[model samples]
Target: MEENRGIWVFIEVTDGKVEGVSLELLGAGRKLADKLEVPLAGVLLGHDVRKISAKVIEYGADIVYMADHAVLELYRTEAFMKAVVAMAEKYKPEIFLYGATPNGKDLASAVATDLSTGLTADTTMLDVDPEKRLLEASRPAFGGNIMATILCKKHRPQMATVRPKVMKALEPDASRKGEVIEEEIHLEESEMRTKVLQIVKETTKTANLAEAHVIVAGGKGMGDKNGFMLIHELAKTIGATVGGTRDVVEAGWLPHDQQIGQTGETVTPKIYFAIGISGAIQHVVGMKNSELIIAINKDPDAPIFDVATYGLVGDAFEIVPQLIEKFKELIKEKGGEISYV
Candidate 1:
């Protein structure tokens, strides 16, 4: 453990750009590195990814270990795992963080198994003990009822796969400078077991709740499918996106993609309207980072109010309709071109 030094974030490149979650991890790793008084580094692995090392440094990495090769052009678990494992063994970072995306999770698991290190998956919170040099990775456990912080006491490099939209990224500084260390990949395309045949992109049009400026998320308190329409109407009127709690999705009121909670997509919109939500810890972990949280529930003591910026203790059915009318009037007053902000 004493041999390990610095914090490393796996910088996943997609479409020739850094993934948002990877950048977020860099922001998170910065704090841990600062606490431990160690340099923050990033592990970049991909073909033609040398140009992105500077961007990684700008985000917060003090050093970037890059492995540029054609075998890594597509995300093959075997290829990425070999590169990451080699870097981990050679450099020996104190902590390693990866995004909890499909590819990120796949690569992290393989690397952890090869290195025989413990990995905390779907981590929502991260902290480090300066004295012990242990990475405190917390996530919802026991069916999302309580948060359990996992520690890798015996491991050389503490590793975690963090969920997206839960952490904030640092402001990029164009003038920031960092060291780029290029690692040699020992694998070839012929040695790889998996090959990329073709790429199929999803053509379905769904509400981009994660990037929405404003979101109207409802829960079982909305009563039923017809009652849930109030949430849709409000969102539509305000030019916002519609989201739902797990119960709402399970009840067939909303699709799984629109679900917001520990098991759903984490979102950090500009404004989040949590209507008729009781604010379970599971649900809060997903959207608690929103800029402005407005929770409307008949129960004044609902758990949601604890984290809400504004709490409306009233019937959502009555309150939402009135709000819709007022918003319509406001839109009409503004020539039907009002922005929700």
Candidate 2:
């Protein structure tokens, strides 16, 4: 236990803003910190990155370790790994948390390997065991039917990557403040392994699953495009967002960002509407962390019912329209707009 130390959260950022999963990790990290009675630290890397550092404290970081460099601005796995490895070597934190984003996972895997520490990826839950000085990393296995807890025993810095929206970000207390641990990278720009010659941002309909309080997702059982559209309409009337299972996304009915499953974006909306979804194990892994789940499928025995707070046996097309209308009425009475349409 003496070899293990404090917690470190990677502040994932893109488009000049910190990613949603980073905040969720902070919230989860804060719990681990309090339980262990140690500091919760955040690590950041990029150019002009100070802008996002303050929010980490507001969310719940006791200290922020920053290494702002031009090479780190864009996610070049090798360079990012170098900076992180250096930090770990300099200041050895017991546990390191990263988001499940492409960049985060790639860098974390490389860092964990180089540092000789174990890493758990796509974890849905995290808890620190004080008696054992262990970090319990929980993630779904065999689809969503089972969950496995991983431990990195006899490791100096245990590392884990968690899904976005799986854990709640603590509400910021503006009055709260924390220390910032500034760091510098001594390597010259020419020493970098990868060079970023040009950058092109993809233009696509990227969904806002992070900002959504309510999300309505349709799966293969939606029957076709029309069935999925009905689910989208319901999401609109409630001012909610629209999502889909991997099948729906593959069908080209929804964008990649709207896909919620083991290989897709993980979401934990306040209210989740699963329409015509068969509740495959992969799909369940992503949204099982949701606060409240409401499932509607014709099959009464669908696996979705296992975790749903509200389960209804009915046709999605028929039920979705009804729910949309009901939501419209409710929102209108209270004066609000449904944006999903």
Against the reference, the lDDT scores of all candidates come to: 0.91, 0.85
Instruction: Give residue 340's lDDT in candidate 1 (0 to 100).
Output: 54
- Show how many residue pairs clash in every candidate, following the order shown: 0, 1
lDDT of 2 by residue, 72-175 (tens): 77878878898999999888899999998888899999999999989998898888889888999998777567899999988879899997777889998767
Reference-based TM-score of each model: 0.95, 0.85
Model 2 pairs in collision = 144-281
Which candidate's lDDT is highest? 1
Look at candidate 2 and tell me the lDDT of residue 315.
Answer: 84
lDDT of 1 by residue, 1-341 (tens): 78999999999888798999999999999999999999999999999999999999999999999999989998989999999999999999989999999999999999999999999998988998898888899987888888899999998789999998788899999999899999988987888888889988763323377678889999999999999999999998999999999999999999988998788878888899999999988899889999999999999999999999999999998999999999999999989875655
Instruction: Give residue 290's lDDT in candidate 1 (0 to 100).
Output: 94
Model 2 vs. true fold: TM: 0.85
